[model samples]
Target: MGLLFGSFLNVVIARVPAGESIVHPRSRCPRCGHQLAWYENIPVLSWLALRARCSSCGLPISWRYPLIELLTALLFLACQRRFGWTPELVAALVLVLLLVPLSFIDLEHWILPHELTWPGIAAGVVLSWPMGWGRVQDAIIGAVVGFLVFWGMEWLGEKIFKKEALGAGDKDLLALIGAFLTWKPLLAVIFLSSLQGAVVGSLLLLVRGRAGPAPDPEPGPESTPAPPVGPEPVDTGGEEKKAEDEEEEEDDWEPGPTSIPFGPWLSLAALEVMLLGPLLREVLPVPLDMLFAGAR
Candidate 1:
């Protein structure tokens, strides 16, 4: 089930960003538009059998396919071992399904589409109904608090620093996580995510000279015929100078060296709190254990 779901998630990760229908169009090779057969789409097994290349155009398939499949299988197995056959286990499975694609999508595109986060938030609330009304209330409060916290930070950052400190979709992702985990562990989630994101982001900046994955370069402007050569025009009333200054200001607003996506860190923290918090609390020192003790 995990392998199958992982295969489907690959579709979600690929299509959601492009505003494409994950269902209507069948999986096809991007290079040759070759529609895959049922046998060709059998998760990791198919990838291995095909030698990680498109049969039609011989385009090399990304290794991420099998990695995601295996990661999902292992995570599902871990959830089973932790929660057993219960409603909580079912909830865990759904959370994993949502988080896996969300994390990868943010890592790749640095955007979390509402198509996933909004539905995920609702699903988390609805799924908690079986646990109890108190849990449902907690989930609701958690979602509200989670969104407001980030929103506040965003507002403050813009007011003080005159720049965007958080991505537009980060609050929604955190709210979705809160809807699943409830309010009690939100502090721990924030702490763990910040700590881990800082460490990894610093390393990436040192190695790659940027904290986040670089965005794809947009195509340059189309070539045009050159105008007749003439003497350079003089600035008239300083208008051209003002225009150049404004352009420079706009360029200054672009992302800097330490701009990393926060969504992946948030997702990772949520998964850690859900799956490993208890074990961590048990093994760590008393002071440190308290940080991980707030799991739902």
Candidate 2:
């Protein structure tokens, strides 16, 4: 079942980014544009058979496809083992898969698209009813509070820092999580996720060096400059200016970098709560306990 779902997840990962339906469009090789046949799509078996290369183009397919499939399968099986054949286990597995896609998307593209986050919020709420995890009232309250808390923090952070701090996608993600975990754990998720984000973001900035002067100032009427005064000013002059631009671009690409995916951190927090939050409440140290006593 996990392998099968991973196959479907591949379809989702590939097509969702291109604005294509994961159901309607067949899977194709990005390198060669060859539509994969059914046999070629058979999860791990196909990857092993093809030797991790596209059949037609011989382009090396990313090992990540099979790895993700196998990883999700193991996670699903592990959740089942831990929680057994229960609605809670199923819901937990769903959250895991959703987080997998969300984490990878953010990692690769630095984005958490609405295709995942908004639908996830709705799915979490709808599925919660069927799973009997919480009442509709609880889920609804979770959604509202979850969104507003993050939104409020975002407003405050901008005022204090004079820069956009939280990504909007993160708010949507918390709202989705709140739909499943309810209002209580939302606070835990926020506290832990922010701590994780600060530590990880600082490391990434130290490594990536602040991403090219904050990315051209987010395009506004004021930020958008008037057209050049005269002709385009071609490079008829010195090699020095061109060399400077190349040096700047190279500096942007330098390595020794780290960027943590916050979705994974958020997912880990939610999973911890799902797995052992109750247990921890009984055993946590006084200082940590004091901070989240209201959650208890």
Candidate 3:
């Protein structure tokens, strides 16, 4: 069932980015625009049978579809194993669904749509009552703390760097996740996310060479190129125009993709916290249980 659900999720993943309604239109091949038949749409099995190619166009499908389906299935099974049929199980499942979409979306676009995050927070808070796990107060406080702390970090980053440091969506994402788990596990999520980000970033840097600087935006087709630097009467002949251009370019440039799909990182962090954060609490040097017990 989870695998099947994940297949549908692939449609969501592809369509949501294009500002399309995920529920209205059915799935189709991107290359050929062929609407998939029910048989051809059967999650992992269909992918395997088709040999990861579209039935209509013979286009090689991305392996990500099957992988995501399989991953989601395993995640669902793991939650069921741990939590059984409790409301916590439902909450965990919701997290998995939302995270799957958010993770991939952020990876592709570096944006976490309010369409996901805001609704997630609302749903998380609403469902907390049925789960009877955390109090409403805790969820509210978590959201507040999560947003404010991250927003402060963003402000500080911008002030220091003289550039926007974090996307507004990132702050919203933290708030949304924190609303569900409250402050304690949210902290765990942030810590784990930071650790993961650093490790992944370092590995990528190593693999891809020191990150290349961002490219300048491509000029529109109709735009004309500026003439090469020539003798402009400047402050003095002592100041070389060529040297000034180089310095200006260096100062003005921003790094390319300093933003990794942070939504995905946050999603993974939330997943870890949801599943095993309390266990980690037991192992922490300072007893996190003592700190969060009152909040619970």
| Candidate 1 Cα outliers beyond 4 Å, as residue runs | 218-255
Clashes of each: 0, 0, 0
Candidate models: Cα lDDT each: 0.80, 0.66, 0.69
Please give me the total number of clashing residue pairs in predicted model 1.
0
Model 2 lDDT per residue over 107-220, tens place: 564456888888888877777786554455677788888889878977986676443345567778888888777777777776776576656555554565431113222333
Q: What TM-score does model 3 achieve against the real structure?
A: 0.80
Per-residue lDDT tens digits of candidate 1, residues 1-296?
89999898999999998899999789999899999999999989999999999999999999998888888988999999888998888888999999899889887876789999999999999999999999999999989999999999889866775556677788998899899999888888999988888888767766765666655343225433212111111112232212222222322233334567788889889988999878878878998788766784
Candidate number with greatest TM-score:
1
Candidate 1 local Cα displacement, residue 76, angstroms? 1.0
Full-model lDDT, candidate 1: 0.80
Task: Note the residue pairs that clash in candidate 3.
Answer: none
**In model 2, what is the error at residue 78, expressed in angstroms?**
2.9
TM-score of 1: 0.87
Best by lDDT: 1
| Candidate numbers sorted by lDDT from highest down | 1, 3, 2
Instruction: Kindly indicate the candidate among 1 and 3 with the higher TM-score.
Output: 1
TM-score of 2: 0.74
Q: Which ten residues in a row have the lowest lDDT in candidate 1?
A: 226-235
